[model samples]
Target: MRLKNKTLATWLTFFGGPLGLHRFYLRGFGDLMGWLLPIPTALGLYGIERVQTYGQDDLWSWLLIPMLGFAIAACALMAIIYGLMTPEKWNARFNPGADPEALPGRTNWFTVVGIAVALMVGTAVLMASLAFSFQRYFEYQIEEARKISQ
Candidate 1:
C-alpha cells in the first residue's frame, strides 16, 4: 500500500479542496468527485460573466452565485475537518500497511496552516455577507424615510 503523507493531503485540501485535489491525492483517479467538481465551477464562472454583461435579469447567473458559494464553503469546511484529524487516525486510514515506527512524527505545519487559512477565510466571508446585508438594510431604510418625507 502506498503511504500517503497526511500533511501533504491536508495542505492540498486547504489549497485545492474545491477542485478535489486532496481526494485525488488520497484515492487516485477513482475519485470521481475530484475529477468532476471543476465542471460546475467553470459553468458558474461563465454564468457570472454573462450576468455581469446582461444584468440581474439573467436567472442562471443568480443561481451560479449560490453554487460557487457552496463549493467554496465546502472546501473551507473540509480544510477545518482535515486539519483537526489526528495523525494516528490518518495513518490508520491512509497508510495502513506502513510500519508505525517508520511513519514520520506528525508535527504538521500543513494542518496548522490549513486551520489558520480556514478560520481567516471563513471569518472574512461571514463578515462580507453581513456587511452586504447591512448595507442593503440601511439603503432600504433610507428609501422608506425618503418616501415618507415626500
Candidate 2:
C-alpha cells in the first residue's frame, strides 16, 4: 500500500510539531533524534530553574509541577502528529512506482521500533526532570523552615 497526495506529513507538522512527524516522514535515525528534541529542552530548562530556586526536595515543588503538565501537553501534541502522519491504510492506490523519486523506500520494523524507543526515552527524561525539580523545592522548604527556627 501507499499514501500519495494526502500531505499527511504537512498537516501533522502544523498541528503537532512537538512530536516531529515531519522529521519521521523524511526517514529514520534523524527522525528519532528529532522526535526527542522538544521535551528535554522544555523539561531540562524548567528543572534547572527549580534547582536554582528551591535547592532540593523529595516530592515536587509548585514550580516543578508545571513542567510535568507541559510534558503531558507535549506528549499529546506528539501523539497527534505521529498519528496523523501515519497512513490509516496503505492502499495499493498509494504504492510507489518506478519513477524513482516517487518511491523513497519502505520502513522496516526496526526503524519503527527505534522511533518508538526514542519517543519513550524523551518522555522518561521529561518525567525525571519534573521529579527532580520537585525534590529540589522540598529541600529548599525544609532548609527555610530550619533557618526560621534558628
Candidate 3:
C-alpha cells in the first residue's frame, strides 16, 4: 500500500470528518465507522432544515440540531488526534509497510495549522451544542413548571 500522509489525514479529518471522508481515506470504504458517520451528519442537517421550516420551538429540531454539532466536534477532535500522533505511531497505524520515520508521517506546518484549527473549531462546536441543548431543555422545564403552578 502507498504511504499515508499524516498531514493530509489531519486536514481531511478537520474538513470532511462528519462525512467520513477521512476514515475512508485511511481505512477505505469498508470501514464501518466511515459509512456510519454520515448518518448523524445527515440527521443533523435535516434537523436544521426542520428548524428553518418549523422554527426553534420544534421538539424534533431541538433534539436533532445537537447531533450535527456533536458530530462536527467529534471530527475536529479526531483531526487534532491525527495531527498530534507521533510519526512512528502514525506510520505504524496507517502506513504499516513504511519506515517508522517515513517522510509522510513527519510533522509539518500544514499539520500544525490543522491542529490549531481543529482545536478551535472543536471547542466552539462542543460548547455551542452544550449551550443550545441545555438552554432548550431548561426552557422546556420552566414551561412545564409554570404549567403545574398555574
- Per-residue CA lDDT of model 2 for 62-118, tens digit only, reads 454555445544644454344333343322223344243342223335435434543
Sort the candidates on TM-score, descending order.
Answer: 3, 1, 2
TM-score of decoy 3:
0.97
TM-score of each: 0.72, 0.40, 0.97
Q: Against the true structure, whose TM-score is highest?
A: 3
Please count the clashing residue pairs in each candidate, in the order shown.
0, 10, 0
- For residues 1-150, write the lDDT of model 1, one tens digit per residue: 567876677667767876778889888979899998776667667766976898755555655644554566667777677677676766677777666534431536666887788878866654554564455456667878999999
User: How large is the C-alpha RMSD of every model relative to the true structure?
Assistant: 4.8, 9.2, 0.8
Query: In angstroms, how far off is 67's CA in candidate 1?
Result: 1.0
Better of 2 and 3 by lDDT: 3
Give every collision pair in model 1.
none
lDDT of each: 0.68, 0.49, 0.94
How many residue-pair clashes does candidate 1 contain? 0
